[model samples]
Target: MENNQDSRQRFAALVREHSHSMFRAARAILDCDADAEDAVGEAVLLAWQAFPNLKNQQAARCWLLKITVNCAYGQRRGQRRVVYMDDLSQAAGSAPSPEPSGLWDAVLRLPEDQRLAVMLYYYEDLPVAEIAKTLGVPQGTVKSRLSRGRERLKALLREEEAYGF
Candidate 1:
């Protein structure tokens, strides 16, 4: 049981280290700050329960991100209703930094697969193979998503610039 305690401690430390990245990735998928936080909370609980199954601590970040994305999807699925609110002040206060905000909004507009690929690659700095494994897709598929996402982001950014946003 001592070993189990040690493992749980280590896992908790790793979770603290990667929590921000997990939240960002979740937000990229879920599109709501509160929902993203909820997803991360759920992911952390699920990950802690499964900590004994983690073999390589070195891959913990990628592993955590996979859990986060899955939880975000589950959160989206569990939402019973969608309410459209025109009030923007609450959301405006939660915006990321200027550079990331522009890029983030563009990324949020991309298709789900592409948004995920871009987030894992650029935001988390995971390699292609690791991303493919996390996403459970072929390397070619991940690459395709990245390429298409970039093209779409470029166009979106251009439009934003033209609109002075």
Candidate 2:
């Protein structure tokens, strides 16, 4: 069908435009990066299948993020094995430790609402209103989450990285 062809093209374009957003949502919702990848991948597939229902192309990013988050949440609900990255044995103390992983460890320690808010606000660079809409919460809730999350990160990261500097 001509409509199907057009929809397919539009869907592909939207995916390219919002891939990073979907990936970020997946990463925040799923604990592990690999699981996040899987979630994003699954979300893309589901989005394409549901493309006909999308009325406004401009809404694609938010729509995709919703799918990504939902898919990651679903995966989390069904998963039991905890991913403990620290357990991986690195070669002898020859190499210095990584930085970003430590930061992420602190981020991951946050409560889910706070983690999601911080990620959307800082990483995604979304405003409070947008975050509130995406999260189905009030703007005030977003502000509180960002405030508390930032304070906690300041404490945790300083303790981890301050000794050297």
- Name the best candidate (by lDDT): 1
- State the C-alpha lDDT per candidate: 0.87, 0.80
Report the C-alpha displacement of residue 66, candidate 2, in angstroms.
1.3
Candidate 2 local lDDT, 66-141, one digit each (tens): 7887898888899988745554444333454565547667787678878888887877777788788787788998
Error of 1 at 52 (Å): 1.6
What shift in Å separates residue 123 of candidate 1 from its native position after superposition? Answer: 0.9
Model 1 TM: 0.85
Q: Give the clashing pairs for model 1.
A: none
lDDT of 2: 0.80
Model 1 bad stretches (over 4 Å): 1-5, 87-101
What is residue 134's positional error in candidate 2, in angstroms?
1.8
